[model samples]
Target: MILAATGMRREARIIARAGLVPVISGGDAGRLRGLLTAQAARASAIVSIGIAGALSPELRVGDIVVGDRVLIPPRNGEGDHPQGGGGERATFGGFAGPSTACGGPPPRDKLGEELLTVLPGARRGVACGSDAMVITAAAKARLYEACGGTLPLIIDMESHVAAQVAQEHGLPFAFIRVISDRADQDLPPAVTCGLKADGSMAILPVLAALLRKPAQLPALIRTARDTDRAMRSLLAACDVLARGGVGLADRG
Candidate 1:
């Protein structure tokens, strides 16, 4: 069976469209690891599917990034502490740890290449799995320098964890991330506050934030529009995967 790890409810819905049961890990690496550890026994492969921030300037909102490799920083000796009570509980938003040069899982080559066949126009590259948001253009450039110009196509929170967990279980792994923001775009400060401890968006925090800075409305609307485009792209990718049987263990 294919197990999909998604960061949001909308992403879960998209992965479900591809005939896999999606586990919502709430954008927390530890929680993602725990969820996969428990359910990976029956899984033949693990897939990380969701929206991601662009790390490469060439990427735009709605671009599909199919990762050949996942790059994540080593955990700071925390040793299996679950993030925010578990994937099920209310959780704080985003990752706060520093990134380092660490090797992560590679997608099964045949399956990985086949994604390009079924889903034309998808970009294939290394995806950086970060514990914290790389929010600004300057940060993305700095990250590129930090990686010695490794040119990560996108940045996300949970893909590395899924890849790492799948490696421990000897399962094949893949990542499909839709770009929700551009490389140079700075996420609104309130975006983080709007996310609850469980990784879901809460209205109260958003309202409070708007009350404090009403001028952020235009940026917020732009983000929402970009997200809508990304979601639609993700849905299209899911349909392609479903039709091609990309992750089916029984496929020859």
Candidate 2:
């Protein structure tokens, strides 16, 4: 089984469609820990895909990445891990959670790359996973300060929990994320207005918000279109990795 809870919902959707059993997760680190404790034997590897913020000067909307040196707050003074290059990073405000450096350079960090071999034209970079969703310009500015201007390009919730789980289970974890809205993009509040505590759709809030923002249609449509295209690319990659029967050797 391959997991996508480290971040992206799109990853689970695509992986599930490709017949790779997916176990969903979120920012709740404890839940992921419990899942790993219960199901490590059957899991050959793990993958976390979702949205992330860019840290370096190189990254843009619709670009895909899959690296692993995640640093969050709540730390105990540990150095950074040189994981893979091709994952998205986080860029946002204050300390949302404890920072844990989950992935380091393995003797053979081939899973993310091998998986991407099927992604064809998808661009690759370093992904900085964090515990917060970056949605505003002010927040981005603060994130720039927090990460010492090595701020992540994209931002979303939930990735470290997955990484922590993988650590405890001794599972090889691969992470992937796409750029939804960059730090410079001022997304309409509607993107999160109707989001409930459970991340479910709220009819009243959505309807009310939609009625209030008639001018947001174009931006919303653009966002939808971009996300759809990105998701399709992720699905295409999943199809190749799963259906192609690509078996990769584990490097010690």
Candidate 3:
């Protein structure tokens, strides 16, 4: 079975329509870990599917960013894997030894490339995963600067974790992220305030937030539209994977 990790219920629904099992996390790292751990056995691969925040100006909303590699920021001597320094690198095929490198070379993921072929206008690049959402235009700028202007294609809260899990289990992994917000766009606070503890959306909180800040309605609507387009693209890619019977060979 192909397991998909999505950050929103909308994305999960889209994955379901493609006949893939999706685990929703609402951007909660702990919950995502639990879900992934609980269902890791039957999973032949893990697909990080959903919306992402653009880290490059060239990527506009609705553009799909397929990850050839996932850049996970270093955790300072935390957990089982102590950080020597810098981010840990995880690719579609397997995990590489820890290094401080930002964007050394673009790793080739045939699966990522194939997904791009099925998805026109989709670009392949490195994706950075964070413990939390990359909120605000200023924060996005800082992250780009921190990457030494390498300009990662996109930013999301869950991709790296899923990749890490796949690595631990020696399973293949890939990411199909769609741009939901532009690099220069400052996301309205309400966009995140609506999230529930389990990562699901609470309609009342979202409505309340919108009620307080009516000015943000237009931006919210635009984001919704872009996300819808992204989801459709994800569905199409899922179909391709399903029809193609794509599967990665076991890693040694």
Candidate 4:
């Protein structure tokens, strides 16, 4: 079976198939690690599939990125964690800690190559993993520069953890992400308030954020439109996977 790890419930639902088991991180790194640990043994291969933020200025919404490698930022200290409330300290062994530093590349796996066969026009690039969302254009630019020559083209919440788990178990791993926000854009504050731990949307918190900053409505609308486009692309990609039987074909 394939272990499909994603950040939201919507993404999990989209990738659900006869041979795939979907696990949602819901923006929490610790939870993602735990879920992957529990499911990794049952999976022949692992895949991280969902929408992601673009880290390259040239990428626009709905562009598909197949990660050739996943990069984790170097640890500052014990307290320094990914944007969310997870203690992803840099260490070795298992999914508890990832092995790669910001510019370091992990071992290449065949899962990404297989995904490209089913996902036509998908760009293969490096993916940077973050605990928190990269919300502003300036922050995205800084991260892009910080990686130096590695040049991660996309950023997301779950790929690093998924990669670690796959490595720990000696399983092939893949990362397929659709861009929802571009590097030049700043995500509206309301975008951060809309998700719940179970990966469901929380309308009240988003409404409260909008009430506090009414002027952000236009940006929020644009974000919504971009997300819609990304979702459509993700759905199409999932359809191709299902039809092509990429993940289902291999039971190793």
- Best model per TM-score: 4
Q: Please give the lDDT score at residue 117 for candidate 2.
A: 69
RMSD of each: 7.2, 7.4, 5.5, 4.6
Steric clash pairs (candidate 4): 83-132
Across residues 67-108, which tens digit of lDDT does each residue of candidate 1 receive? 646654322223211122211221011112222222333333
TM-scores vs. true structure, each candidate: 0.82, 0.69, 0.79, 0.86
After best superposition, candidate 2 residue 9: deviation in angstroms? 6.0
Q: Residue by residue across 53-167, what tens digits does model 2's lDDT show?
A: 4544456666776555344432111111212222333211122333333343333346656655656655544344443444555555454444444434344455555555666
* Stretch of 10 with least lDDT, candidate 2: 75-84
Across residues 1-252, which tens digit of lDDT does each residue of candidate 3 receive? 777888887777767765668888876888897899889887877778888888888888777777646765444222212122435433332233333433233243466656667666668766777776665787777666544446346888778778767766766677888787888987777777767766577889878999998998988887678777766767766666555544432311
Write down the TM-score for model 4. Answer: 0.86
Off by over 4 Å in 1: 73-109, 150-152, 197-199, 245-252
Which sequence of candidate numbers ranks them by lDDT, best first?
Answer: 4, 1, 3, 2
Q: Which stretches of candidate 2 lie over 4 Å from their true place?
A: 6-11, 26-37, 53-57, 73-109, 122-124, 148-153, 193-204, 212-217, 245-252
Candidate 4: segments with Cα more than 4 A from true spot: 17-19, 75-108, 149-152, 245-247
RMSD of 2: 7.4
lDDT of 4 by residue, 71-138 (tens): 66553222222332233324221222344323333455666777777788898777777877778887
